[model samples]
Target: MDRAQRLAYNQPTWLDTVAAWLLALLWILPLAYAVWTAFHPTEYSTRFTLLAPLTLDNFSRAWEAAPFARYFLNTALLVAMILAVQLVLATLAAYAFARYEFRGKNVAFALVLVQLMIMPDILLVENYKTMSQLGLVDTLVAIGLPYFASAFAIFLLRQTFLGIPKELDEAARVEGATAMQTLWRVYVPLARPVYTAFALVSVSFHWNNFLWPLIVTNSVKARPLTVGLQVFSSVDQGVDWSIITAATLMTSAPLLIGFLLFQRQFVQSFMRAGIK
Candidate 1:
């Protein structure tokens, strides 16, 4: 009601704007450091100079020093293998959970909900044990096997499927469409946004995943980028900051590029596919 109270209510403060910029700066500080160190020579890594001679030599050294090509290939194969199987399995399970009527359905879905709450790290021991028993240790299959059944994917797709009009399902069935045909033609296409969102989450998580891959892998043959980075930056090698930073950037470049390119689609997909 007073002038001071009205001004405070009607206008934003400079302090809030300053705080937002400060937080943004803090968030990007590490990435800024990485870029500076990776692009400059070792001598200039710590010493920030406007005239620091930038060079590609660090990246060249990084690539030649380790089996990065093999690590990249393994990581690509692992993520693709995991995503392919997850989409197939998640779609089917989500369709059934959304549309089918069966005994123990609610209980089964409840179990999945519980699984979503439990951290995958807790299952590391059992998963490793199972993989060992199956003789899949130290393989791409081992790294991706446990994550193939994604509770989060199933839940997201199921929610999307539930929101679809049931009349469309009836119309499809009234035609010559079988149940499988109905699912492929109707549900899958409708839930594409949710699929996109889940795929992004899954890929990013597994791309950065470290401990499980580290434990299961013994050599570069099966090691992903995260594990490869750890081995590349081993303490045994006298720390070369430029080369180490270059290697780190190289490993994470795919994800950074992907997020940059698809950022709009990624945000829209999440918004559109969010629970109604």
Candidate 2:
């Protein structure tokens, strides 16, 4: 009960620990390399030396070469606009799906779920054509168009709403609360965790999205951070690895920082949503 039990309980779980470390290393290694390159001198970036000269030269050079400030502003605007619309639409749709019983409701919801299975990126050609017809091509709105109606968001929120007791809704109604009022005052507050989780996931995905933005935005004025990184990478003058890595860091740092800052909220949201 003493020595043997202590040994059994305290013994290192070598296999599990090793596997976890390997998984962490798989992710951390690339980010570490990127940071190293970002800080390393251009001459030392690709060099095998353990102690190559580190400096701010790459970051400064990358910043000077591109209008990164503009890119950040545009990306922020685009992400905000998309999230705003998605939140409204997803909430309403989720609420309706969770509470209402109408003809073809199941069919319509099924179709919406189908969009989740079919990658939104695959529909780019049709979406681009629609954007062209709407005269929204090459705009920030165009870059956000394809993601405005998120099936996954709708589904997640609907599930969250369903997990709430019907009696809560009935109680709200008994107090003469309208459906909209009940949704705002009751459901939304209760589902805050799911909303936070979804927002984190959505922001991360849209922040890193490159292909749709690349296709829709033709100018730096509308290009998001991802497009900005690509444009810098594709410059024909020459390939500068150090500068490229620096640019990548600048492009991704905001999302990384946001994740770190909101990690507790993000993790709690996902956990609560999962339990629901």
Candidate 3:
């Protein structure tokens, strides 16, 4: 090609560059606004002035307005407990579906998958009644019980297991290994990326989950960050945007810090799971 043609081909389109910047700003603007509002004093949040003096007063006031420390602890406990149960349940379920040839397997798997189509919040009434019947209402265990077996987690892990070569199982069999042994030694290690990806997603989901926890947990002993933030937000006659934003930031900080600290691993796990 001639130099003129090559020069034209190499030139970047201004529209494309402008679009990229605009898209970046679109995604970043909300986070920027939250941080800005969180740092400002209560009186300045609704103001458009960028140069407004910042203060720690909003965060201090937000902290004092609610039992945020207890909320954080509860949320962390709930997430950890649910994830622990889910990991074991999903692993066993996926192993059965992947390795066993039981009658009606497909039908059973289909029923599990049907749970995914039904929004979890839709079952709240029935679940609440069940909890009441079991006398487990207003407990952290009740908050975590409904999610013990995750359809999505089972499906993800099953797909990961199916991706492994059948020869691995055969090889383990030649060495006198049982199905469970092979699964533990060969499949679990290979599926670590999927587990990590699912763990991160699950933790984020349960951490932010509100309605179920709100309905089940009546006291500070089991109430989570979302419910706590609501209490803080509604304390004033008119909601103070600055204090609410500060509370929100505080509530989200742990997950935000977790993602930041494990960002590379998180990205790699998701990418690996996607590729599989």
TM values, all candidates: 0.92, 0.92, 0.89
All candidates in order of TM-score, best leading: 1, 2, 3
Greater TM-score among 1 and 3 belongs to 1
Q: Would you list the rank order by lDDT, best first?
A: 1, 3, 2
Cα lDDT tens digits, model 3, 1-276, are 665665689864666689989999998898888888998876677686968897898888889989888888888899999999999999999999988899999999999999899998899999999999999988899999999999999999998898899999999999999988998899999999999999998999999999999898788888889888878555548888888888889998899999999999999999999844
Q: Give a tens-digit lDDT track for model 1, residues 105-207.
A: 9999999999989988999999999999999999999999999999989999898899999999999989989999999998898888898888888899899
Model 2 Cα RMSD, 1 decimal: 3.4
Question: What root-mean-square deviation over C-alphas does model 1 reach?
Answer: 3.1
Please say which candidate is ahead in TM-score: 1 or 2. Answer: 1
Give all candidates' CA lDDT scores: 0.91, 0.88, 0.89
| Candidate 1, backbone clash total | 0
Which stretches of candidate 2 lie above 4 Å from their native place? 1-13, 48-51
Give, for candidate 1, the lowest lDDT window spanning 10 residues: 6-15
